[model samples]
Target: MFETIFTAANRALVAGLLAGVFLIVFANVVGRYGFGVSLAWIEEAARHMMILGAFCGAGLALREGRLVAITALPDHLPAGARIALRWIIVAVMFAFMAVLLWLGLKFVAFGWDKETMSTGISRGIPYMAIPLGCAIFLVHLALFARRFVVQEFEFHAEDTPSDRQV
Candidate 1:
């Protein structure tokens, strides 16, 4: 169930939000230069799309271990110490996610009362990405943490093609 839902959401966000933002920005640029016309709403709309994409994209990035990490510390540690540190990292991440979600909801509430300058849309709509992204980050983090606990290393080995394999 998790895999099914995650797959669909990840794909849709990349395809829709990410792609849409790029297209809108491109059009705005072209419209401004070629036609000498500025779209006030386009900028606002693109910003929202970017926020949504960043939040949604976070889950996939976490799953892929594409998020930032301090590799030197982990690699230098002994096996047992490394494992212990992994749990610590995951715990910190979850805590951060929880705070983000809690505070993000409040932010969204605050935004709901306000509107964008250009689009006149509720800022909450864009702020929604915070809590939403936090949730997605939590889910992916859980999956990765579970796998990390089970396998001491090479958590993403299955997802990637090893160079040595023929």
Candidate 2:
């Protein structure tokens, strides 16, 4: 349930970010050629949208296995070795996400007293995305690791002649 909600939010964030970019470009073009009235808020809004988009999309990327990996070595390894290496990579990723969650929360706590100049939104609101996204990414990573391990184990088991049927 939580994963579904977060995934939806991630998708929405990406769509919003793309829309913001399109609006900014369209506004600029219209202002330059048609109205001679440029929008000052478009750039600021676009910047904020970009940040939110990147953070929000990160969790979804982890869930979908879309992030880049150095697969050259893993690809050459034997089956068991490859599975072990993959597990190691997941462990490292989990550690990184933990650090990110801690630091991101600290950042938000420190900035909670501040407010944005134009929007008047609490600065902490935007900063909260860091920790929130990282936490979600951590959950997604753990689930992914569990699935990988389970699948590999099952595959190996099934490959055995005693476990197979002709």
Candidate 3:
């Protein structure tokens, strides 16, 4: 139940952010070229939205096995070796994300006093994407770690072999 909710919420958030960014950018472009007016804040808003969307979507990408990876070595390795390599990779990802989350928090704290030039919102608001993304990524990694290790890459939750068989 928790997993379903979390995944759904994460997907919604990412989709919303991306959609907002798209609409804003489209409007900005049309306004600039067609109407000969450009809102200064539009660029800043779009940039921040893109950052948030990319970061937030990362976990979903990982969970769906959409993240870019070089699978040549893992693909050629024996079953046990492939599994062992996956475990090592998972450990590295955990450590990397943990450090990123910590650093992101520190960065947010540092930016709390600062504000964006055009939007005038606290810079921490945008800086927050890092830690939030890392946390989400960590949760996803934890939830899917077993499947990732065992399956060695093809682990889309809805498209699993059992589901297909049924």
Candidate 4:
């Protein structure tokens, strides 16, 4: 289940999206100046890819335990206390994911009829990334929760597997 979402394929998708953004933007710049012509759809594609990349990258970061932390409370807490803190963190993530998923779906529905300026793609296509990202986050959190219990409060950044390719 969660393994499906946290696969190397997703890592490749992120890499592809990032590459697409860079190439499109670069071509757009070259066309605008070097050739004095630019494709109208290029900007939209780049923007959408960037948005998707950002969301997917965020999920990857969350899954790998790479999100920035304050460490204010965790620094002072004991091992037992840290487990309680992590539980609280998971609860907060669940709540946040629920609301974001709901709003993202509504947003997708609302934009179903709307199309992009250049490609005429339904806005819902890109907007769908919202819920997709949340879904990824939910799966990640679930995996973390499982490990969180089995590891006996032993949640360390080093213990989380990363999908990054060096």
Quick one: best lDDT, which candidate?
Answer: 3
Return the TM-score for each candidate structure: 0.84, 0.72, 0.88, 0.81
Q: Where does model 4 exceed 4 Å of error?
A: 1-5, 146-166
Off by over 4 Å in 1: 148-166
Model 2, range 1-166, lDDT digits (tens) per residue? 8756756776786888788888887878799789888766666666677777777677566554456656678779898897888788788888988998899999998888998776667788878878877877787666567664334322233355554211
Task: Give the distance in Å from residue 111's predicted Cα in candidate 4 to where it truly belongs.
Answer: 0.6
Task: Tell me the whole-model lDDT of each prediction, alpha carbons only.
Answer: 0.79, 0.71, 0.87, 0.76
For model 2 the TM-score comes to 0.72
Inter-residue clash pairs, candidate 1: none
Among all windows of ten consecutive residues in candidate 1, which has the lowest summed lDDT?
Answer: 157-166
lDDT of 4: 0.76
RMSD of each: 3.8, 8.2, 4.0, 4.9
lDDT of 1 by residue, 28-114 (tens): 899999999889899889888888888888877666555776768878989889889888888998999999999999999998999
* Position 27, candidate 3: lDDT: 96
Among the numbered candidates, top TM-score falls to 3
Q: Which candidate do you rate higher for TM-score, 1 or 4?
A: 1
Residue pairs clashing in model 4 are none
